[model samples]
Target: MFPADFAYVRARTLDEALDLLDEAHAADQEAKLIAGGQSLLPMMKLRLAAPQVLIDIADLPELRRGGWMSSVVGGSFGGSIGALSTYRQLGRDALLNGGVIRGRNENVAPHRAEGVPAITDVLTVLADPQVRARGTIGGAVAHGDPASDLPAVLLALNAVLTIASRKGRHPESHLGPYTPRRTRKEPLNIGKREIALDDFLQGIYTTDLADDEIITHIRISHQGGTASAYEKFPHPASHLPLAGVAVVLTYKGGRLTDSNGHVTDLADGSLASAAIAVTGISPRPYRARAAEALLKDAFPTQETLAAAAAQVTTESPGSANRVSLLGDQHASADYRAHLAEVLTRRALAKAIARGGRSL
Candidate 1:
């Protein structure tokens, strides 16, 4: 099913895209932005997104141009990751995908781990090099597909998004934070306000986005010494994750203090901070806090799967176990959940292993 006829606009500058966004939003409130047209165009071809206008922004300087090529990290104890990184690129640099991958590959860059098993899985999930090459990090985040891998990766990595309008630029935000009770007001909602990393991105195929908002840039920090992982339950039909999970763990190491003047080999990296982000289970990427606490305490194990399953349900109380196949064959939502649980355990395990015996 081809898309209905629509006006097309090729934006050359940031201002042009912003102006087009305003016009489109005013006219129909559902116009789509095309970056690389990798994701959007196909959706258009299938009539999944029938925007009245297509504003191609892949050519825009802001989204197309990569910054200076320079390595930010280096040392004997802690090595450096080279520039222009990709999941495949990191593997070329000897980065581990998770030491254990639960699913197949999505060969584009989720860029979650410097090198981890989950990263390679995500690269493969995104499919052939041709599609991955044309895909833009900014487009995926803005598209905010719930089943999409990068949304989960960005949420876990605390990747910040920038939105530009006629009013200049403002921070992008998402919605979410599930609770124990169904009675409490859901805390995930974005508004005409400044959004921080922790509070953005609410649920699957959902966001705090407005009709006029256009995503401009993505901001992620290179510090934090985070040991990270990504996991996905990819569809047999599409190879896109039915559910995806990502994790970041920080640990500290130093000389031991005297306890009764005795020192022993409990010397390993002590988890300093930890964050778990899960996609596919909910409307948006959500922090798996309970699973995080368990992983933080015990690292990854078979038991960790139980803890994650518990917490993931907390975020997605309304998910259906049934499958709504788009074609002849596909995976059910329940199967996806099971897959997510598998990836969660592996990703957490991988990050912890990377933490190693730091102390």
Candidate 2:
């Protein structure tokens, strides 16, 4: 099947893309932005999305750059990836794939970010090589697919988004207007703000993106002593996760004696903070806060991990039998919940090992 007839317009600049979107909204015409066209094109061909106009921003230079910068004075390490950055670029980037440098300085202290392993793990099995080459991170995020691999990882990292638009150019965003997560220098000439990935994602195939706005970049940050990993059970054919889990553990000052009488250096060798997120088993990917609460500040023992993992089902925390799970031919809701539990345990173990210490 072919996508319905639509007018195609290539945008040479970020402002031009916004202007195109603003015009479409003013005329009450359906317009969609296309970057790599990896997700949208498939939906269009299936008649699930039929925009009357397609705005091409694939060639915009501002949205194609990907790099990271560290702030030692602030005691924070972070970076941003452009909206047009493809999965292939992200997977191959040294800095993104565990090359992150953290802590004060090399002479005084050095550390690795806890967030890199999850990014590397997801990118490795996200899809086939062709899709990784063409699928942009921004597009995958903006598409808001519940089965997406990256969103779960991003959610676990508490990622932030930088958006560009002129105020009042489009109707209010579904999740409301943008709110800055922190203070940052803006472009001045254009309206810009940052949003948390948690707030940015509203539902399946839905997001907080305004019709007249464009996602400029995705920002990620991590404290010095954190460890994170991602695990997924992919479908045999489509390669989408039957259930995917991402876990991030933040450790702080302490030492622990292992079963072998060897001392391990950690923040007490226990989890100071833990974030667990699950995808591909519900209407939306969500942080397993209830499960996280169970593991936070505790030793990641086999018994403790199993107990926390069991709390990762689609059932709402504090509610009995109130659950919503995705049921399809590939897997039933019960099966997905089981997979979520299994993956959570695996992700936790992998993250702990990556932290270079055992509980």
Best by lDDT: 2
| lDDT by residue for model 1 (216-326), tens | 545444333567767776667776766778877765444555968775555254565567777765555566665566556454445654675455544433443322211
- Locate the minimum summed-lDDT window of 10 residues in model 2: 180-189
Residues 2-73 of candidate 2: C-alpha lDDT, one tens digit per residue: 999999999998777888998999999999999889889989999999999999999877787656675544
Clashes of 1: 25
Q: Give the TM-score of each candidate.
A: 0.69, 0.86
Q: How accurate is candidate 1 locally (lDDT)?
A: 0.55
Q: Residue 2 in model 1: shift from native, Å?
A: 1.9
Model 2: CA > 4 A from native: 71-76, 100-115, 168-189, 254-266, 314-323
For the record, the alpha-carbon RMSD of candidate 1 to the native fold, in angstroms, is 10.5
